[model samples]
Target: MLLDKSVNHDEVLLRTLAGRNFYASIQTVVKQKSDGQLLLYGIIEDISERKHAEQVINELNETLMKRAQELESVNKELEAFSYSVSHDLRAPLRALDGFSRILLDEYQDRLDDKAKDRLSRIRKAAQTMSGLIDDLLQLSRITRVELTVKPVNLSQLATDIIVELQKEASEHQVSCIIQDNVTALGDAKLLRIVLVNLLGNAWKFTRNTDQAVIEFGVRSSETESTTIYYVRDNGAGFDMAYADKLFKAFQRLHSANEFPGTGIGLATVYRIILKHSGRIWAQSEIGQGACFYFTLGK
Candidate 1:
């Protein structure tokens, strides 16, 4: 160049004679010599590695976005299926229940003892199926609901649930020990469901025991910032071998006759804990009591 000026070009891509790509920073300067001739200077620096890294990052981000979209589509489809099945089955379930009840009531004289028993069993199965459907809808709805997190007095909530449980089954004589000032930051309604399921399971399991003692408290952890809350009971605890199946949908460790349940409660609890970005686990042995521990948030 024949100018007395300086210019800079940053991170310019250059190609070699062999067709390989490289990145470089270029600068140019012009100077006038005493002989009235102009001199030009240029400097170049390679930045090929940084350019290649940026390209890889861009590609990774694009792939992640596509995968996220695909997952969202799958979730929407599953939610739609859950909702449709729940809504559609309710009508037929009600019809079955109603018809069976009517037959038992109206045809009592015409039907024999075995026929009446069969009708009763049919009605019970229908009711159980209806309960299962309701639980499924609840599990599906929990994901869609907006979470309103605030400082919730979990101690009070536990006491209230115990009160309701006692009122429902006043026949059970069990003692409950709830720790005072036990609070957590979470959605009140969702957290209440968690407690209801856990505490209810405790009460149910302790039914066969001579003395039932249920407790709710927080576990202090020296290494963790979050407090671990737990529900403990002296009842018919489950075997640790089947612990892995505890939180799966419709997985029951006990027979329906021994313990009447839909098996969706723990699965719902698992989903709720996951939504809050927390963890849950249980410790138990056969004939020993079970203790369920969980964290709400990070």
Candidate 2:
């Protein structure tokens, strides 16, 4: 047992002879006490599987990080695009509406009756377009606003809104009976818009009836856990076939001559309801009546 070199013989020198994992050899420089000689030393083991696993894990993490970065970039781009459309596009529409109205008023004598009517129509369309653009801007803003659940007095709100509407009435006998103790958690301003649009639509559509009847109150549904309040009206109700398209942007069931609107009202209502975590739906038939039911989250 004479040796002149030291080696870690734990793995049986797996790289020396045949370089196998289970069996191996070791070379060394050894000399007796009289003479000295030397030999090469080699020791290796198979760790290929473990190294491959580590490489795969590192590659997976890299791919996941890149995917997350891409999603974040997409989100930022959408926000910037919304800002551009809402902020930049409405400036020219305002100018168009303002100038048309100004020309009509200041140059009344310069335009004949038909010409003036056409000009008036143009101004009306422009103003309507402006209103539509404003609604779109509002819709965009609604998406970004943080909503909170606060006490909303639906009864008082309905009464106030209805009284305001009645102020503009000439010969329409439309009244509201807002049930007492109808308060809930919702955005008051947005809820007011919901009331305004729903009730205003009711009032406008019922223009042809000899006596317009509209009501606002809560009604029980077997399916819902919350009290569903609805604005019911005897009006020019639409066909059920178009009901599915009712809440979409720029979708109008009636022509501008019959019932004029920019078709953004229902879309606004839908957005407001969604923001409140509520639901809204309408039931109507041609010339019967329409009812809009909505409820805020509890």
Candidate 3:
């Protein structure tokens, strides 16, 4: 075919007579000389390795796409199951809590001391179980909600949350330091949840300190355009050995007697940050207090 053409460039995958594959790029040029004789030039370069690499990449891409689809399907099923479980338990919890409260209010005068105490215990247990149910639902919702990303004034958010916390616990005299103009790009709602959990933990752990101090700020990274935000507190810090369990669902570093919680807040925060393509970590010493650091990807 090249012998009949004046000038041509083509790439061909050829099977040699020896029965092996070879990819070759061919360039040909032909011109009529002054004496009516033809001049022919041809160049052929082997491109087998490049073609093989492209084939391998295409195969890898197909496999990755299939895996991604499967993961998405599995995640949807898990979310549905969580929703069902939480919904089923909520009705019973509400009934128990409502009945216990009613019995205590209407029958306290007729009931004995032991009976009243038993009713009180039932009420408290019902309330705690209700809280756990709510936390499970919240975790599931956060995991499944679509994120709405925008510029958020993180410092202002922290200040708002701190003010609310102070109002709720007016007896506690704590000093809070929030850096001005600290900001980031993320889902404002989800970021608020993260701050609420982190700041709430700081506040809870600091209850034993006479004059608790909490700080919220951002530090510039040396080699990246991203900022690292942190919440620090002078409080009852936990052992570093248990740090790995901090973000798992229903894992608590501190006992409920010391810090009353459903052990789901950190797990929720972790999911929110992960949805934002971010990272979160903590540093602490038993008595010196703790600092939590996080980054929202730019």
The number of the candidate with the highest TM-score is: 1
| Residues 125-160, model 3: lDDT tens digits | 989988888888889899788999899999999999
Provide the overall lDDT of each model, using Cα atoms, as 2-decimal numbers: 0.92, 0.80, 0.90
- For candidate 1, the per-residue lDDT at 40 reads 82
Candidate 1 per-residue lDDT, tens place, 9-33, comes to 7567899889998898878898999
Backbone clash pairs for candidate 2 read none
The residue-level lDDT of candidate 1 at 182 comes to 98
Candidate 3 Cα misplacement greater than 4 A, ranges = 1-73, 220-225
Pairs of colliding residues, candidate 1: none
Better candidate number, 1 or 3, judged by lDDT = 1
User: Which residue runs does candidate 2 get wrong by more than 4 Å?
Assistant: 1-91, 221-224
Tell me the TM-score of each prediction against the true structure. 0.85, 0.72, 0.76
Q: Which has the higher lDDT value, candidate number 1 or candidate number 2? A: 1
RMSD of each: 2.8, 8.4, 4.3
